[model samples]
Target: MATTVRRAVLTLPAAPLGPENPLPPLAAPGDVHRPAVPRARDGEELPPAMARRMTWAPLRSLLPVRRRDAYGRHRQRTDLDALVVENDRLRATVLPGLGGRVHSLFHKPSGRELLYSNPVFQPAGFALNGAWFSGGIEWNIGATGHTTLSVAPLHAARVPAPDGGEMLRLWEWERLRDLPFQVDLWLPDGSDFLYVGVRVRNPHHHTAPVYWWSNTAVPEAPGSRVLAPATGAFHFGYERALRRVPVPVWDGADRTYPLNGQRPADYFYDLPDGERRWIASLDAHGHGLAQTSTDLLTGRKLFLWGSGPSGRRWQEWLTEPGTGGYAEIQAGLAPTQLEHVPLHPGGEFAWLEAYGPLAADPARVHGEDWAAACAEAAGRLEAALPRATVDAAYAAWRPYADHEPKETLAAGSGWGALEVERGRLELPGTPFAEGTLGEEQRPWRELLRHGVLREEGPEPGPSLVSAPWRELLESAGPGPYTAYHLGVAQWHAGDRSQAVRSWEQALRYGCAWPALRCLGAADRLDGHPERAADRYAAAVAEARHARVAHPTATALAREAVEALLEAGRAEEADALLAGVHPTARSHGRFRLLRARVLLARGDAAAARAVFDEGFDVDDLREGERALEDVWFAVAERLVAGDGPVTEEVRDRARAEHPLPVRYDFRMGA
Candidate 1:
């Protein structure tokens, strides 16, 4: 039997490998070379070649493979222990945590996101020191994000005067997590403060152009009677005062307005100077809520009361028929576009109004008691609003306010690490990935080809799309234009059912031009051609009567005319287009419609002549493609059944026109 002798194995710890450490360096120039030591049998040195191989080669050759594996495992354990020591040394020398102070943290149930402060960094221009607290109002920011409100300041003002006069400002604060956002106001006293206890949804930073209404909910009771001073007609189309006699309520016989058999509409009015409007809502116990707003500088008062119904029964009481009411007072700010005001970087833009609970009858409480109650209620509202904190507030607010936070990568995470092991990926290789690139390219190429509109001045056509139109449609919120644009977007996106729903909803509130057109288009597409025709007709009429002028109204009216003509109601279409003042150069399209009507009645000669003349006289520059389409349809019809090309048709076809040929002759096409 052969006996095998085993030698005891020894392991060495791994040394640190860095410039400062005395561990073995990686192979580099001028490094020291150490002589190898070899194992010997019974004090006899191994062969020179074997000794060199043992020193440089892996352990597998000198011992049984399994024994070498054991030796390798022992070496790994030793190296791991050394690494643990090195890791602790590095930790001792490094900075441990972030440098900033914790300001606040919030957990929003709706979004389910955790917002916390980082102690390492602070935003410039402010300081924060506070414990994270909960329980605040939720407000929508720009119709997309929600922020919490902590404290709402009742008053705020700027330091310097821009117009060389004393300006008093009032603002309301929304403590968004840690940051503070404000809503500013200018009161009569020249002293301004933040507004209190109002939810402003879909607020813009400095560029708010959409319409907003202040919605207030008041508690109601059976004996509650509302009194509102009206200047003119109510904004809603309901009768302000209904009486048994035809005499006007202005004749003044106690104006006992009754809501017993009638539905009251929402009323809005402006207040006149030195006028005080009152609303008395009395409960069975003789206690009720009264709201009042005073123009401290002008001595005007505005008031409103709850009507106990599900909705407020609005009323207008005019001290004078021509003027004097809340409507008049508010009118000063009417046609109010928030973009007109100059707001500071983080400053907020807001409208102001005062509201509180008051006694139904002035005699029920002493003057001092009424004042005290008003002040107390106002104070509570002030406390419930949001306020701004410094530095860390911004960081806390943004994480919660952003639309999609989960998709954002953590700082220092490499892009390469985000890829899946086996999947196809499409990365953006260039900017201008959106359709905006096409818009930019078109104008540049146009300028290069046709040259600039004015060699050294601004371009002749609009350099930018109208902001008011875009703002009214694009800004998030339930507004006239927003509803209108939503319908249009949905319609264009091929969601005809949804588009119809949106347009119908918009019409219930108030009719806007785009909304009416969209509704008509949707109705037409959904097999309600008659209803669609009615909508188009109504839109044209409304545009003609609109108080505010819009350029798109003309295009919308023309579309309505076309819709009516295509529906085989040529007489109605003619009557509508008759009022439109088409220029000599632009009358071709309208005349073409007329020719179509004549052709449908089997008057080929008349239709052919009308089309020839209209087609020849029109500029047809912008809608060249449409012009060609019409020409093709007419030519195809005339040339049908071997009819010769008439002189009028041949001359018309020779005109320079460029358009594709696609014609729809169906109802309301």
Candidate 2:
């Protein structure tokens, strides 16, 4: 451990640049529920029990916050409280006041910034939630996009290191998720690499999907090139469609070249199947960043807005024009945000990623060349320090996590400790004017156009059919995601047979689990329960075969069990539910299906027990809650022989739990 020197606050002459555009104040992020308003069944509004299930969204304040003033300026300015740390080989600056982001990372040896440092603190309304700021490796955890705490302050400490090195730790208790995360960024004395270790803990007895992607932004200019270890990848597009393409070579154009044309594309590509790690970008002179984790499981993602007019408009929209647009080299834990791994109750997730600068002559030009470079690069990094020194440094790391720490920022202020701490930096957030609503259109459109699963709805277009166009989308080498949407377009056009055929082709092209799940939903909606069950089963199989089981896959398995129960096939339902993970088995839907199965087998007492016992309904949405209530009500009526579920019982249950037509991840599903 390094000695703790006398702490001194220094006033700097120059300030970091502020965002060109301030984030518009956000209203709490929640689904835009198009609820079929509660109808009056009786003269007395169904006597409360028949009332509709509520749309109780979690408090929005808990998500990442970007308070806006009357002119839409981000309340927390980026110029102040800019904490700086450095070593012999590298230097890092942290903006504690600006969401605690590592604002800049410069390699002293190469005099190059390994990470992009936006001159302006620009935030985009692009997150799955509402607020997102670009630049640096922003820690995105909780749901898929930006975390609630992304913009808020994180409790920060510049921990002392005995060896004259720097170890600054940032920790926070995520209020909405009931989880705590700690990120320790260590720059050892004389070391070339910056070590980032993140630990997330879920202490609740309920399971939920946890998301994280270390978003690294690097300068994308005329001389830059990308390198990853894969031949081909699953490319997710700007229109929220999918396709498979050879890595760094899409439409036969080498994507590694920074100038890959102006027909803008946005995609998250899955690298080749094997034990691989590292995703890098280097300029023509071979100077940039190479990042990797302790484990080899990482996805290489590229976000390139075309050089075209609309694309440039978006580039400036996100930041500012003339500042020059940059591309993203994201290292993710999952292929797509839709298929994140589920974190079990009381489970812990930990990972270590290293960001180091690299330079090579004639630099890597393709995926194959890059993979070879990574192997040598990894060895060189490991050889930087003694084995014991590296091992002891990490092993001695202590954790600081709290879910209910003492509140600061003055009583009733509602700002968190980090926010208060951020205030100490001198740049303060301005309060919004009364009745001011956050600008949500940009975020909503961003999701609709680029996001999968959690978007608002299908991109607006004719919901009717065009046979000739359908054949073209299906046959013109469209990616799986593109094909799936094509099938959807066909289905809306009154071509069910063609839709199925189109979807199956994408399934065969390695679209994996999502395709099968989509088919299952369609079949079930079409009243083909047995066929849907088959599709769900196949989808579940694919999910299980992945390095880790996916959330939607298990959710689909629970759905399949429901289908079997609906078909009065108790044994089939029982067998399938048995194979699901315990956490999934505890889902309210699965338990209700089990209860239904028991009732079908004449086990009234057992069925009642399933309902009487507590159901883990903590993380479920309105629909799931409604389904649970309805099932329990039905079961109670059947068990008590209460004269065919009287209108009173039906009304009460329906009122308590009015499920949407479908409860799923899909927009509007």
Which model scores highest in TM-score?
A: 2
Model 1, residue 201: displacement in angstroms?
Answer: 32
lDDT of 2 by residue, 4-88 (tens): 2122232332222222212111223342221133322122232132132221222332222332211122233323455555667
The local distance difference test score of each candidate is: 0.30, 0.53
* Candidate 2 Cα misplacement greater than 4 A, ranges: 1-78, 160-166, 261-276, 363-669
CA RMSD (A), model 2: 25.4
lDDT of 1: 0.30
Per-residue accuracy of model 1 over 139-198 as CA lDDT, tens digit each: 222110111111111222221112222122212212211112222111112211111222
Per-model TM against the reference: 0.26, 0.50
Q: Model 1, poorest ten-residue lDDT window?
A: 62-71
Candidate 2 local Cα displacement, residue 596, angstroms: 51
